[model samples]
Target: MKKWFLISTIVLLMIINTNPASAISNAPIHWGFTKGKNEQQAEAGKAYDELLRKHHAFYKGDPNKKVLYLTFDNGYENGYTPKVLDVLKKEKVPAIFFVTGHYLTSEPKLVQRMVNEGHLIGNHSWSHPDLTQVSNEKLKEELKKVKDETARITKQKEMHYLRPPRGILSERTMQLANEEGYTHVLWSLAFKDWLVDQQKGWKYSYDNIMAQVHPGAVLLLHTVSKDNADALEKVIKDLKARGYTFKRIDKFK
Candidate 1:
């Protein structure tokens, strides 16, 4: 009887070790973007769009309106977010900030300020790993860690949106995130704003952003870019001059 019990325990351990949910897949397609003259410019293709819709993900919104949803990916604070916040406040524009574990732990005050100022704080995963390469267990943990911590710091119970780290995602990853009650939020417009030294000046940033302005554009700007911070006011002004309006991601529909 004891021998049989030992065998059963071994089999149980093996089952746990080989759980199918712990498996990872090599996702074939990395997210891509194509610059175009209108809403078609940032299309992620029909297949991709259907897949995202199956999992309730979004990169842009309301293709018929000239509205822009602004978001920032905050992997870490570089002392420039305050300026960004200032610009948003002065302009009365709303945005979402996708943050990591380090950003939450290191800049609790800034995180709090973001919450206080009526900006949405989203989960960017704990360590910013490529979720497409991780097992469902690890993927959930990565998202949950940041969500729990952000809630702890900001006193908010729900973090409803996620931007997959490095913009890497798979269909399975999106399904798992959806099961965890998150809407995957990707972007329609992004540039080299994350690299501090590679900044091409505020004018260059302004021109590039304006050139791509479209109906329902979800613009992803890195808060760490001083060029972005400096150019935000003018960017908003120009966008408004062109009849564009800023909106929060929750209001995308």
Candidate 2:
């Protein structure tokens, strides 16, 4: 009876091990991603393609309307993401974070915190580069590198949006993003906050951002700089006063 029990256990282990669904995918995402010739092409680059994709909505209408979409690009891992999260929490607002693998692998807890706080995290590619010029294979690597790492960290299934590095886009880039199951999020509202200039204080940013505020505004800021994190609270208040409700840009909003 003991021998029979041991044999049953061994068989069960084998069955589970051989199942594709049961196995963890540890393979490198870069193994298949390649670079494209979009930049060199006389016409347009190849279309973007990926193994999976995720995005719920795009720009609904005119940019000058009442809605504003707040987004931040995460290139480097700044200790400030938590502070940014704190500000967002206090204001009860939702913003999109365009994140890179550097940020994901280095600051995983912050990513979890972002998810917990009900904010959208977008695939900002593995490395920050112009996606419009990369091949579909490379495009896959650019996105999955983060998605896979994020999955491992969050223990969650998947992410929804992907905005390529530098906000660069091409036919191939769009196709690749689509294939990867992501919506190519573009910003109708962005200013010098992307700049690293420290002189561009909260007042400068506030005025510039406020001037450009319209419906469905996908405002881009960086988490690495003291400027953005510092500007968060005041910006939220100013927008509130202007009668704009901070929200996720989607079908419902």
Candidate 3:
């Protein structure tokens, strides 16, 4: 009986040791953080900072440089992206747009325009599902579909960044994304500008950004917000006057 019990324990240990899934946590994390104020850097807390660091994810760049990275989450178009693009073009600033599969299929022209305008198209998953619930195979399928379709439409050879759907992530998800050659790009500055119905005015968007602006900030904006569209050019001008240089995601260091 003792021999049998020892054998069972050894089998259990072997199973635990061999299974990588058993060692990694898939707990869903709805990304949130302490917002920066007065040019102070935002903090994602010690635990989250360590988690991102472990998987080579980035929320902001070097804190000493007066640099800004503009990123947009394009889950679905609401007709304001063209205005946002116009502002970027006029200001000579670079930005990245994390797009969904729906966006890819429905707005291929805009996707091509994004590539043509020298902006990046990042993966926001094929269906915008909570990635923590997906299997390894499903996750790979999701990422590949976006990359493949974006390449097909835009003729852009490589895609390299991902923003987990609904601002959700986990260690397992980040690891899976990194394994598939994509880095997680979270933001250091954002606000409630995504609610199309609740927009106060262009000033509302501009104020939130200026209040949170800091060295090495990654600003996440939604192209669907009309206020953001109206406020973008002024925001760019003001930020430039403040000595902040806009940069692309690939240039982060």
Candidate 4:
């Protein structure tokens, strides 16, 4: 009887030791930007693509296609989204707007316009906290509140895409979010469009965007930038000239 009890305890310990849940690491991820069209950049992009593929997350579109997926991060209303929406409407381009709690509560009208205009609205968390630092319960609450509220207001039930705040994500957080039925969306190309005070003029915006235009690019533009608003129309036209087509994120993969 004593031997049987000891053997049972040893087996239980082995099972606990090998449990997958116990192996989850909560380390933070430092996202690095892939810069310039060099071999190094290409390799980095490929590695990133593999990482996303492993976790079923997305940072860019299909590399074999001449398609661009456009997304905007809307943390707050800076009085530039309406103009951005107008340009999108005029261009007949579809985009995804990742909105935080503040944007949803303060700019319901704009949110409604986005849905009505056939643009996709994604969850950008409730308070824009670094999800990696939050507890799993808080993470679920953050995502759920925004999703519930957005659905309540927009009458749209599908809001499965999640863009981590400030573009920071960890392996554990990504897995947690995926378990909640969200596909994490990052960006292949993003500039300093979010810094309002560091505006480099519309020309700088135009050149920066145009120079990096590539196939299967997931382009992130902050809706709060005046320079982005000013250069949006011309950028779209230029992209068309280069034979690139705009695709919605849902259809990107």
lDDT of each: 0.86, 0.65, 0.94, 0.85
The ten-residue window of minimal lDDT in model 2 covers: 36-45
Question: What digit string (tens of lDDT, one per residue) describes model 1 on residues 65-93?
Answer: 98999999999888889999999999999
lDDT-superior candidate, 2 or 4: 4
lDDT rank, highest first? 3, 1, 4, 2
Off by over 4 Å in 4: 1-20, 36-47
Error of 1 at 250 (Å): 0.7
How well does candidate 1 match the true structure in TM-score terms?
0.88
Residue-wise lDDT of candidate 3 within 1-253, one digit each (tens)? 9999999999999998887776789999989889999999999899998999999998988889999999999999999999999989999999999999999999999999999999999999999999999899999999999999999999687989999998899889998898899999999999998998998999999999999999999999999899999999999999999999999999998
Give Cα distance to truth, residue 235, candidate 1, Å: 0.5
Best by lDDT: 3
How accurate locally is residue 132 in candidate 4, as Cα lDDT from 0 to 100?
86
- lDDT string, candidate 2, 143-177, tens digits: 88888888887744677687667655554555556
Better of 2 and 3 by TM-score: 3
Number of clashes in every candidate structure?
0, 26, 0, 0
Which order, best to worst by TM-score? 3, 4, 1, 2
Which candidate leads in TM-score? 3
Clashing pairs in 1: none
